[model samples]
Target: DSDSKQKKKKKSKASRSDEDYVQSLNSREDRNKSWWDDFRESVEQAEPEGTGKFLFLKLLLNETCEIGDKVLVFSQSLGVLDLIEEMLKIASERGEGLKSSKGFYRPWRKGRDYYRLDGSISGNKRQNDIDAFNDTKKARLFLISTRAGSLGINLFSANRIVLMDASWNPSFDTQAIFRSYRLGQEKEVYVYRLLAHGTMEQKIYGRQITKQALASRVVDSEETGRLF
Candidate 1:
């Protein structure tokens, strides 16, 4: 519905102008993620609120990982996924190899499956990413934006998912969970909902759930959880 944002500009030509614009956007995203990753430790410390989420996910995933074990991290924006990848990277870097300490297992995620939140991916690219995700030798994490990657995707390879941010639409949450909770999921699907306490996220998520049933019954439903 209205929750979907407009598609990014697309170019059908090999012009330098189009290439430059896309490159700039990519550069901006890279710079932003780099800055955030650098500040993530301080941010975590300043915001102890993440403890509830971190602990919850740790418990859900059992802090252990295996090949072909996929995880889809759901957030409101694409930028959040980038930050999460950095968090995962940090986790993997701090002596997180297989034969390490007590809680040192992060999944073997690839560089390509760090997809944007939407369906901006081309058909070929999507399949390649999916293939890698389902590959037993390569990937285990599939970080995605809730708004973009929630529907029409089979994420049955994962037994767990982490919702980085709650949405007003419970169906949005439902669709996101289906990425793992769908058919062929061998294990008990565990979905962790992360809500930022004492923020607009809490109120919006609560109100959104209340409206979920009602909204689905009508045609002209109000989409309160639209893009920021």
Candidate 2:
């Protein structure tokens, strides 16, 4: 079994190098520049707001992922997603930056450019996003909303997930987590839930739990968890 795994890894690596090189050759950017250099310029020049959210995004892009890695990002709210798109534009303009209050941010991962979830993306573009995230020839980041990407989406493409905020229902979060946790993932799926310390957010989380538990099923012992 170990030997078989080694062979599989070797085959995957060889195929990836071939594809990445082909993509490099096919790219129309100045033949003088490699994809990495172009990517760096984009990330650095995109002018993102210097907020806590970008701080987290900086860390996320810095995570270690090999070629063909998949990443599912759940920002939870559309407002936040919009903010992320703004940040990404900054990343594109700035090349690579880590604008944080603590003064620590660096780029370590070799990645393909990212794709933000948008209404305009569908069909093969959607499937290609899924595949590229898995293959790493095209996807380094996948920005998604939990509600949309959670249902009936095949995300075996990559093995990393970051939920900018955990939904009110743990089950909703569960659905989001399972996108990668489903069958055929060769790597461990990492789930990160971000919560602000000592805020109204905690109460919100508790209420969501109570509501989802009720919606999931009926138990006589539970009462209300909603704001009603």
Candidate 3:
């Protein structure tokens, strides 16, 4: 009985020592990790399935493309446009087909199926892309920078306008929507404004609504006074 008790005590000590060694190794590894490693891990965990905004945008694109509708996606930031372009390219490489209503729809190809316009592009190239988008059946998506695309641009070819983010000034968003809702548009126009529920975007959009309401009231008051 004494020998058995001694053996049991030794086994218990060995088990505790093994557990302590594992905990020490884990602590050492954590100490060895740099800030960049921690940051990357956090980002990967946060965006395990890409961003919610981008995922919804992809679903919207799939539906619109399947029905043979062209889309104009506008973003206030050039960086956002760049990220979208990269996403589209990656989707194209994965053989993600848009499956248009037309019997012979092909897989989406950048430069052929989609176009981009921004301040960085030369005026000639911008006009050329616009023309291609307007004239070609294959061109189904156009990604535009809001500041650069809001002025003197006509995109009657696309009936769907996607506002990827809100603008501080409501007129910028209005102009972006009207790009596709012009005189020559044959189909019904649809506008989609994507905003994260608890973000600055919702605040900006609320402000935009208030500003528009105030402007309308001022105009109505002016008209009422003028009639008398």
Measured against the true structure, the TM-scores of the candidates, in listed sequence, are 0.63, 0.58, 0.74
Q: lDDT score of model 2?
A: 0.61
lDDT tens digits by residue: candidate 2, 29-135: 44335444545555543444444556875666655333335567885565566567666655545655432234443332323466655333455676676666666
Best by TM-score: 3
lDDT of 1 at 143: 70
Error of 1 at 131 (Å): 2.5
Residue 196 lDDT (model 1): 75
For model 1 the TM-score comes to 0.63
Locate the minimum summed-lDDT window of 10 residues in model 2: 17-26
- Write model 1 residue lDDT over 1-228, tens digit each, in one string: 433432222334323222333443565577656566655787674432356665565444435343334467777655455455555555556644222134445443456433433335565776677666665433446777666677777867777688888876778788888888867778877777788789988888777766774666587665544432
lDDT for position 176 in model 1: 88
Give me the runs in candidate 3 sitting further than 4 Å from their true place: 1-49, 102-107, 221-228
Cα displacement (angstroms), candidate 2, residue 12, comes to: 45
Ranking by lDDT: 3, 2, 1
- Backbone clashes under 3 angstroms, per model: 1, 24, 0
Better of 1 and 3 by TM-score: 3
| Candidate 2, superposed: residue stretches over 4 Å from native | 1-49, 65-69, 97-112, 118-120, 208-228
